[model samples]
Target: MTTYYRDGDVVITSTGIRMHGREYALAELRQVWHRSGRRSWGTIAGRGVLGLAMLLPILVGALGVGIALVAHASVAVTAGLVGGGILVGLAAAPLADVLLERVDRSYDRGSRRREIWGRTRHGDVLLLSTADAARFGRIYRALQRALEPSRVTR
Candidate 1:
């Protein structure tokens, strides 16, 4: 069988598609279409919220130190607060990194996602769903190319 697309166990071939251990025969697909919509944002943004939670106490402490400095507090107390806040902020760096990474991914993944669907003898079926637009485009185009040979008149 000629493989139009192959990625791990998921494949598109002359005969059909095999993904997630499910098989779909190409002959059974009468028509195919694409769908795009928003993805669930809560999970990604939630991490940022949690990060904000973690940093709030640090921020409040810093603000208190600033006020103390402005009010001519003793040098030893100001120095201690500055030193402690630095240590705590440094200690929380990894969690802050995670928060920033999640925020970046949310932007990269964007608001919309893509899906492929096909009409078959039994009914309509979902062929693929992904947040990765590049992969989706590649697979969808491959499916189109694989089906094209059958549609041409000899």
Candidate 2:
């Protein structure tokens, strides 16, 4: 009669847990575990790209200032351009963070996965996974609570 967790695709009640159209009775659930996978190469590459994007502007600006100074531009102009370039580079930090966040979300949306496996008394395995960690945790913990016997008695 108690509802422990309910997400869009996963639900856990006192009687059972239902996920992705598959259901397992609480009394029959013998084991439940969370399985995590390794980070994908695409995620590593995306992080590298984001880091370079954050630093490239600053490096380019410094190179530009050096070139202008060597070309005999006035000290005042060089100084002003360097200051402006530094500001621009600082501005790019937030932009880079935003881009990194977007990339992370996109990868999570398309590729990230967390698996929850439940072994039933009948030797059947019920599996479910999702991209959202909080949601997955809710289902995982709920199932654990349902399977575990309560210590306190009325």
Task: Kindly give the number of clashing pairs for every candidate.
Answer: 0, 0
lDDT for 98 in candidate 2 is: 86
Q: On a 0 to 1 TM-score scale, where does candidate 1 land against the true structure?
A: 0.61
Model 1 lDDT tens row, 1-154:
8989999756999988886687888777788888997766775567568778668756866765666567666888778777776666565667667767776666656556888888878887887888876778788888888778666211
Candidate 2 residue lDDT tens string, 50-145: 778877877877776666667667888878877776776677778878877876776555445788776665674647867666666666777777
TM-scores of all candidate predictions against the true structure: 0.61, 0.74
Q: How close is candidate 2 to the true structure, as a TM-score?
A: 0.74
The worst-scoring run of ten residues by lDDT in candidate 2 lies at: 145-154
